[model samples]
Target: MTIRMAQESDIPELAQLYQETVLAIAPHYYSDEQTHSWASFAADGVRFREFILSGTTFVATDETGILGFAGIADDGHITSAYVRRDRIHQGIGSTLMQTLLDYAKNHRIERLYAEASEFSLGLFKKYGFHVYDTEIVERQGVEFKRYLVERGVIKKD
Candidate 1:
């Protein structure tokens, strides 16, 4: 698979991937209501498009299609990270994350941070992110726990 900057044309597929991955994976860590509510975030095409454009988004693709996508905002916040449901556990997420981290480092971002769900806590930890805060946040009328994780970037002289 190849990873590259996301183009405007990829928004529809990215939106679908985000919704499907959330719905398919959230259930393992969240209640059904929470899962549905979380998935609803991708239904807003305007917001979703704005989000993709708001950051440096990357997509992993191969002969089949887009397998995963991730993004990092200019402020060092990881805005989105999702792998296609069928493509989970195959290192796609990790690769996408590494790409984002590499971009952060190259761009001289001092720290990277994100709100991670239970399903993604392990992956964040694997990348050396530590949870500095935890909270129960409500989205779409459902409450769920999330971790605020951050990692400082070491710049090479």
Candidate 2:
């Protein structure tokens, strides 16, 4: 597998996989309405384009298509990271994270954080991140719990 910088052309597929991830994973913790409510149907193209075009985005791929991706904010926050939901548990997320963490270290970032959904809680923990706290938010009478996790450990590339 090869993890490479994401190009603007990769945005559409990334968005599609993100939708698939949201749709497939949300229901494990939320209601159907809540899941669909949180998702957009017409394709949220602008945000994806902006993210890929902005500063730092990485895509994991093999002979097939995009298997996973991670993005880091300019300020050292881990903005987004997701593996194809079905293709997870094969260590793609960890690899993606290590790659981003290496980038952060090279750039002299001290800490990185991400709002981890329930599906990702354990993975973050495996990477030595500890949850500072959890936030519960209600939307349309449905409640969601998200973990605020941070890790300051740096790894050399």
For all predicted structures, in order, the TM-scores are 0.97, 0.87
What is candidate 2's TM-score against the reference?
0.87
| Candidate 1, 21-121: lDDT as tens digits | 99889898888999999998889999999989888999999998999998999999999889999999999999999998889889999999999999889
Cα lDDT computed for each candidate against the true fold: 0.92, 0.82
Model 1's number of clashes is 0
Best by TM-score: 1
Question: Top model by lDDT, which number?
Answer: 1
Give the Cα error of residue 41 in candidate 2, in Å. Answer: 7.9
| Tens digits of per-residue lDDT for model 2, 37-90 | 555531757766776667698899987799989889877778778898788888
